[model samples]
Target chain A: MKGNSYLSRKLHSLLGVIPLSLFIITHALTNFSAVEGGSERFKAAVGFINGLPLVNVLELFGIFIPLIFHGVYGLYIAYQSNLNTGQFSYGRNWAFALQRISGVITFIFVFWHVYQTRFQVAIGGITHDQLGMTMHNIATNPLFFTLYVIGVLASTFHFANGMWAFLVSWGITVSPRAQRVSSYIWMVVFVLVSAMFLMSLSAFRGDEFKEAAAALDAIRTIV
Target chain B: MAETTVAKKSIKFVITRQDKPDSQPYKETFEIPYRPNMNVISALMEIQRNPVKDDGNKTSPVCWDSNCLEEVCGACSMVINGKPRQACTALIDKLEQPIRLEPMRTFPVVRDLVINRDRMFNALKRVKAWIPIDGTYDLGPGPRMKETKRQWAYELSKCMTCGVCLESCPNVNERNTFIGPAAISQVRLFNAHPTGEMNMEERLETLMSDGGIEGCGNSQNCVRACPKGIPLTTSIAAINKDTTKHMFKQWLGM
Candidate 1:
């Protein structure tokens, strides 16, 4: 009885890894589409995106509903484990700490992303897929570019780390050898996702690329 | 002053002794014939057999809790050489000369090495870390989960309630009533359950209250310190998202 609640709350948080991770992957793909036609193409993509009733409506339910459930469950489970398993200490406390921190980073990122793109387009009437044109706008502004790169990197790490933890919670990584192997696998996936996401961003930033390429060429000549 | 001898003599074990939970703790040193493979608990057992300190002082046997002997039960945890770990797993050979043992300070000392963990137990209770089934009648199979989701839930369940995590947590000190990482991860675990979704609103509301998830400062010490390797930091992050949505719902009266 008591155990069931504890398990259910934990499971909900674990399931969250799926939706969040999947959302990022889809987002990165959509952003990559900007590399073809730049701003105008990106705007068309945004129109297509906004037109997709299934995605927009589902996204509202997907992002918020699970997020709220996960939060409440996190609080409850944290307290419950504190009770039944009275052996509380730092070494035993780290895993939960990481899960929560990554959750915070992801949440902050989501809010900012939605504000910059979704809200802007809804209110200011965007001329392009503000979300997709992120690459172009970032290319124009170096500060935004740096922030974008960091944000994408952070998202990838959180997603991969979440996936690994989720797997452990689900009892998939059994045996010492298997655990190490799976960790390596998850690491590779994280790096790949991050690199691909960054690549797409860099590709669309045509002017930034030209400047960076010139700097590299100068360094090559000097060295 | 101590002197070194080259002779093939056995090592000595000087252990603290206590009877009941309310009794005063005392020290009793034992000179056990040097055995290569031995632990604090093993040496204590030897002393228990002879019931004599090195100075020929007879005393009551030492007592502690230990199970699995493999470091999983976390019952035999104690301070060895100024660090917390299982006495059963702490081998004599790996320890420095005159190994020192003491009860974990975070908990109330029960006897010699045993301490009361009631505080932590109460913390878990405060969070209501369990699913309410409503009855003893067997409710045939709950909602099914996709394979991917099931795998992750198993990972969060690996927590064994070892206090080492809390011992290392800075937030879990006397100054704060922070519930710590174990409970937070457990919240992530149960909230992931199929039927558990129903009570999600209730759980998020709890975090919004005093001494809840807001206490976390993003120190990230809990992730590196957990022995079970549970993803605590990630759980903390996931909850942040949950809380924000919850807060939004409250704003609109949802």
Candidate 2:
């Protein structure tokens, strides 16, 4: 019997590289645009994305499908595997365990985020500065601010570490030195991306989007 | 209180049994007269000789696989007292009873304690975990490796294909086609050899394929489960690095 289940493994890796990672990196960078470019750049970017033809189909096929697959498949893998970090406690072992843990957190964060924001805009008929106002309101709340920070960290860590794993498993970075180089690069990515996400969140904490958020709050109160 | 003069000197066992590969497995209890310094294998032998259950009914001998009566063969590997290891080396004195013996469920159980370890062997085959030899004639005194390299390679060569590592591994399940740690480690061993480097690309390519190295979730269970203390995770890391380099070479047509 051919014992090797190659398709699932390849698909998981492929999905991580393509739509999943691609979407995540783009999403993070776009959100980071709020750091200096203000709400106009952020809203413009969101508008551009929302203005695309077949935006619903593009999201369902290009983003949601891949994200759900990668997230769910990753969970199944984590479930089947035994954690030995408690016994072995090596750096690589810890990294392995942390990857799954971060994956779970990121999955939850991403889902909750989309539910609170995306669905509200798409299905709930809430729009016009939806991204800016919603995020600003969320950050103003202490509990949600903490969650947003954690979500940012978790997603960034997942992407950065996942990139290293992707390179190694795909036979890209084969030498110890190369693997180390990739590790260093990914670590840099984690820090920079995390800082960018935090800075964007911090921008929301300011009064720049206060009017938009207060308008939404008044609408919510009246409804 | 009434005092008893005869000390109860028996070992209790709760063994998982299946009459055939497709049979429904059930637990069968056995109590055997204890002997000092006896291991699980010896206790099993006593039960085999008696062919009787703890309830005084005659039954077939409790079946398991073992050879060399030592930890080397890997045939004797099973889940003893909840840990996967060679039963021959699991000293009864050290284990808590009633000892539980179960077949390594990672592979198909043949009958009772005998599991088809073909998965592991096939994985080794998949990676071509060997140095290719042209003929039976003397290829007299092949290339000598450095002493330090030979020492580590010898350690990697100690794997007996026992399937314990696979049993402990979370990634090696029915749901996935991971080749497991043993084969990956073996790839490292062969790739380190002077002659083996000729087939290095082939081996690396095999690992780069679907059920290959990418399947590793890095649980770190295999290293702890290896009876020979082989640096399995280390080998995996090394091979992971090597395969990427090999892919680069292949892409560059070097």
Candidate 3:
């Protein structure tokens, strides 16, 4: 097993899609709910997730643990890659290089994002209901807003491009035509997912969210 | 006047040369009288005969490996004008002027334009990329393949082990032991055969090891780089599936 990195590599690919990708989709949709149905809707979505039976266990095994392995191992893989896209300039070659680049960006962004939101909740610095207010504050800052935009783009690209690699490596798309089709499909996924995320970001800065954040702050002051 | 000028036309070559395997490489330029439909190999031959630089200095003849004088042999694979292909088929008419010839640096340079292809041969051996027929006694009329399967498999069989696929692959360089694309495609070719199917599991096991099928980053440069147009990525994807199934079978203790 010393020289055999096969199982580990496959596990990395598997963990990327199984819980990680699934988690990302749910997360984007949940955030989009803030814009679609406003703060109350976003609260209900978070509440429903947090209220699930054995929610802590689910988060630990389903999201956090898998995420740690995927991110840490992904960093190792990114480091191992010797990108020659400058010389090659092939479409897949650029995808290969961009995949690793986006992985690194997404990893850092995800770490900071989880720390700013989820970790803050865990540490009692902000309650679950105050998540909207917290996001509002972050989104209003021009620098943070720009960072969030870049982060969302990188994360979506990583997920979508990763999905393409996963399909091919798992033997789902075995032919060149199948691979070409798969790439086009994933490109669409990247665009749609990125749009969803960016929409949520803009929603945070909306008047409705600002009013809701103000109401939350007023109640907190009164209490 | 135009006929004489056309007859006196010449091609310029800028070739990288190394005196020894461990020595640094240097560039030498040569101008050769061009002929119609002459390929890179022919120009190199003219240089070999003259052994003179464009600067009118006497020099050593350029060295390269080639056989079959056709694309069939994997030999004579060198980087011509920044692309990896066989010099035998790289017609001078098609290439840009002052054509740069260099060794396919993926493999160690033995001399000018000659690379030691032991890595590819080792990869083939590692995968046991052949049917294990007993040659001591005659084994006649082995299992036959379906015409449809044989049609595609025949396309895969055109691999000359030219090392171009390896040269084009980012993962098959000095930092990693990636067995590269050619041998992986060869595995698909052999494993599809009736007699060859016997050792399919063994071959898959090797692919499951380090520097095996797992090394493919899916950059997909191999398929495009292959002069024969072998479906390298398709074979890689197929082998990826096989190895996954094989891993499960091993886990199940079957």
Candidate 4:
């Protein structure tokens, strides 16, 4: 029973980095295309992903299943942590507490973001081409925009800090100096990834995305 | 006149006190005449002798455990000025005013500053943190270790089981069974020994269980808070690698 938990804990750490972290990186890149080449490029990126053979299979195994396991097990781990940052106010101590806090935040944000987009599509509420329009609607709403910003920041921080823990637990960064260097690298990652997500959000609020969505709607009406 | 004025100056101490194992803890302030080069132990002794509160009321002597006044003996571990360390080494001159002394709550507190360290000892037992040898037969000379290896291993041997590493860890509290960092590092120390390596697989197996190596959250606080300057996080990482291999070996039925 104990050995089972050991494997499960390691698997939790591994899954966070392997498919989940990779998915976050790719998802950010796909979103960032909106900022770089307007809604057309964003649509193309989304279309390219949706058009892939075995896309549903990939989503199930690569994204949804891993996400559920990581998110649920992460909540358990968070519950087990005894946060004592008040007494031990060291930087790493704060980071430990924040890791758990951000894990919960990211779990909520990811689920809500998915429900707003993918689940909406499943129910035939919107077409894949209207993803940019859906994002635009979200980004322009004051409450949802604020929530997205907080969610994006929280998710990025969780990933970056989690990567640092992953390196240590997996025996990659063994020495203090290596751990110190790894922290700096991960902080940079946090900033860069956060910038990518924020820029994409801002792009959704742009007039070009509205025009693109309107054009897509017009073509649908004509058809 | 200057000597008289210096004699009047006093040091203030705020100690968290509990009358019994199950009693609620409370704070008591004491003022003792200033002395140069005085450590926390000496101040505590002053309070014990006089047994007077800052309010000028008589009280029972504060109880604490100590053997060697030096930092070598791990018995005098406590939280001083919000850091878990040896009270013997916490210099009054270096500490902030109103030096706060509290029992290390990571273990169950027996009295004022005395805590039961059985949890740490039990963790050591769980990991079998010792080299086995039969006493009946004359075991011949042990295999020699390389000088370089001995040097690093000596650093690990300095651990007095003071429980400071455990006290500083956020994961080693009442809510969880995590064995904390001290025992994990001990496993690393003993496993490296020539004779001790005989039971290396057994130790690694223990580390793969509940309240074992996987319990570490990699907060890195234990390494920072260790008074003996042991490379604890390094040991944990080494153990993690070893456990990974062990887990695979078991999975492959090897």
lDDT of 1 by residue, B166-223 (tens): 6656567565556777777777777898887667777766765656665554445566
The positional error of residue A44 in candidate 3, measured at the CA in angstroms, is 1.6
Q: What tier of docking accuracy does candidate 2 attain?
A: acceptable
DockQ of 3: 0.69
TM-scores for all candidates: the values are 0.51, 0.75, 0.95, 0.96
Which runs in model 3 stand beyond 4 Å of their true positions? A1-3, B1-7, B135-140
| Candidate 1: segments with Cα more than 4 A from true spot | A1-4, A7-11, A14-18, A67-98, A125-135, A138-143, A168-182, A208-223, B1-76, B81-91, B97-102, B105-108, B117-254
The best-first sequence of candidates by DockQ reads 4, 3, 2, 1
Clashes of each: 94, 2, 0, 0
**Order of candidates by lDDT, top first?**
3, 4, 2, 1
CA displacement after TM-score superposition, residue B116 of candidate 4 (Å): 0.5
In CAPRI terms, model 1 is classed as: incorrect
Model 2: CA > 4 A from native: A1-112, A115-130, A136-212, A215-223, B1-6, B136-140
Name the best candidate (by DockQ): 4
Candidate 4 Cα errors over 4 Å, as ranges:
A1-3, A219-223, B1-7
Give per-residue CA lDDT, model 4, range B67-117, as digits (tens).
888989899999998999998898999999999999999889899999999
lDDT of 3 by residue, B1-254 (tens): 55554347899999999989999999999999988999999999999999999999999999999999889988999999888999999999999999999999889999988899998899899999989987888989888899999999999999999999999998887666678999999999999998999999999989898888877889998888899989999999999988888888899987
Give lDDT tens digits, candidate 3, residues A1-223.
Answer: 2547888889999999999999999999999898789888988988988999999999999999999999998887877678878768999999999999999999999999999999999999988988887898899999999999999999999999999999999888998999999999999999999999998898888777678778878998999
